[model samples]
Target: MSEYHIPVLLQPSVEALVTDPNGTYADFTFGGGGHSRAIIEKLDKGRLFAFDQDQDAAEQAAKINFEGFTFIKSNFRFAKRYLKVYGVTALDGILADLGVSSHQFDEAERGFSIRFDAPLDMRMDREQPVSAADIIANYDATALHKMLGRYGEVTNAKTLAEGIVSARARKPIQTIADLLAVLEKFAPRFREYKYYAQVFQALRIEVNDEMGALRDMLHQAAELLKPGGRLVVLSYHSLEDRLVKNFINKGKFEGEVEKDIYGNDIKPFKALNRQVIEPSEEEIKMNNRARSAKMRVAVKI
Candidate 1:
């Protein structure tokens, strides 16, 4: 399990959510099944359901033969409907480790790491039609600027977007190296790696529609959870953390919490922690990816 991908905040996340050994649970992102395995161990007569859209993750899921374990090969955006088909109308706890798995970033052909010069294919699910390369090649300057500015939060995003548009006109931006070649000049001299990561993150997010799927999953998770059920999410970036925080506190990604006619809040979930949780220095030292993770938990009201 450790060789596949280290689960961030494994103990804290699992312990925080799995309050009942005999209670039903769902792991919305199975990844390498580290958290799923931990969840299943704590369950006695409880049933566990997991979702993973990536084929590699599906293959990993097949290897887990734990009792009361079921794997769903679909995006968690469809979690509610899919679990309903399996007669799981309500769940006692739901967990989502939203970080890209080590396997995905480590695989050179996936184009997730800045160190790798592979095809610009950053789709979490290979079946997805739009790859990062497609976004780079097809997005107009305005669309590209929006993606980089909003999703990546890159400095000088507008300039980079215009540069990409000009560069792609001479030749198609089809690979990681090709895109980098055009944007390298715009990168901050001392922070080139960070700039590349931001660009890649934006492209990956757009290619997979990560934010859209996350919003859908959160809505479904709220509906799927029983009253007082736990909802745990570990997000790697601020964009995702913001959404999770908003949804947990306000019941929607944006705007203020709605009020009922009786003058009480109508939010579906209440946040468990006043502030986000971070991994310990020891944990982050061991798994560098854990450094950026922010975990938030909520209880359904």
Candidate 2:
């Protein structure tokens, strides 16, 4: 499990999540099953439903021999519909660790890591038709600029986008090396790697439609969770953390909370903590990936 992906904030997340040992639960990002295994240990008569779009994760799920576990090989955006198929309308808790798994980043052929000069394919579900290369090749400069700036938070995104358009016209940007050739010219000196990371992040998010999927899952999770049920999320970046924070605090992704006739704020969930939780210093020392993790816990209202 450690080789596949070290589960960040494992103990803290599970502790906050499993309020009832005999209640139903869901692990929306069952990357390496580390969290799922811990969750299973906390269960007595309870059942756990795990979801992952990655085939490798599904393979890992197959190794779990627990009778109480069910692995759903689908994007968690469809959690509501899929859970209904198993006759589960309400949940005691839902745990989502939104970081890309270490396994995915380590796999050179997966095209997630900038260290590799592999094909530009960043699909979390390999079955997905569109790849990062396609986006670079097909998207206009405006579309590219929007994706890089909004998703990656890349500075000088417009310049980079225009550069990519000009470069791809001579030859297709089909691999990491090809993209880097164009990106290098726009990247700031001494910060080339950071620039590459930002561009790759943009491509991966677009390829996966991660933000859209997260929004769908969060809305469904609110509906699926019973009153007082927990919604625990570990987000790796600001884009995800902001959405999670807004949904829990304001009941919507953007704008102020809604009000009823009496002017009381109407929201689906209430935050459990005044501030986001971070992994222990020891955890970050052992796994650098834990450094960026921001965890938030909320209860259905």
Candidate 3:
């Protein structure tokens, strides 16, 4: 097993919530329990409910000895339902460190990182039917085009989708290597395969319906929060970050500053901060995975 994922923005995010020591909190992605451990240190009477869909996360969950910690083996999209099982109708604060854990990327078979040569399977939940290979093999050209365009922001989405269709006629694209071979047709001249990584990220997002899950979790988190509750989200990609920023500021992703028909602002949230927070240079120097992280925080009004 590879070293577990190091939690990004660990201190800053926890400090945001732990400021209110007695308030109940939730960590939506409890991989390796780093943030949860910090939250436990702050709480005296408050309890924490954590969620991680991956079975690998459960092993790390076992190591947490903190009292009043409930680690659920499920995804955050189902968080509302699971929290209900624990009788948590509302939370005082919520934090979601979204995207694959470093543990998932480093572990070769999990296939989250382009650094490791492994199967192209990038299911955050491994039991799920959809996998990167399945997307490559089954998705039609139009679907692939929109996936690359919407998620990856690739310029040549249509051409790239066509390339997959053409290449897959000869053999099933079953691994990252196979996908890379197909992707090379449009690979841009760049620094260290960043483009390839972006394309692979787009595919992984589509395969797992990650955006769909994120949308659900965001809406649910909003509903599950008590007035004055804090919502802090760490997003590694632009699309995720945009959704979070808009939800915090405008209360919607459509980019319209939501208001009553009379132009009175109608929002359940007060933007705690307009600028996104990033990892310190020292933090990124220690963990390169922190390079792309952007954290946004909102307080329920």
Candidates' lDDT values, in order?
A: 0.93, 0.96, 0.86
Give lDDT tens digits, candidate 2, residues 121-196: 9999999899999999999999999999999999999999999999999998999999999998999999999889
Which is the winner by lDDT between candidate 1 and candidate 2? 2
Descending-lDDT candidate ranking: 2, 1, 3
lDDT measured at residue 239 in model 3 versus the true structure, 0 to 100: 92
Top candidate on TM-score is 2
Please say which candidate is ahead in TM-score: 1 or 3: 1
The estimated TM-scores of all candidates read 0.98, 0.99, 0.96
| Residue 278 shift from truth in candidate 1, angstroms | 0.6
lDDT of 2 at 265: 93
Per-residue C-alpha lDDT of model 3 across residues 131-179, encoded as one tens digit per residue: 8888889989999999999999988889999999989999989887888
Please give, for residues 94-123, the per-residue lDDT of candidate 1 as tens digits. 999999999999999998987889999998
Instruction: Find the candidate with the highest lDDT and give its number.
Output: 2
TM-score ranking, best first: 2, 1, 3
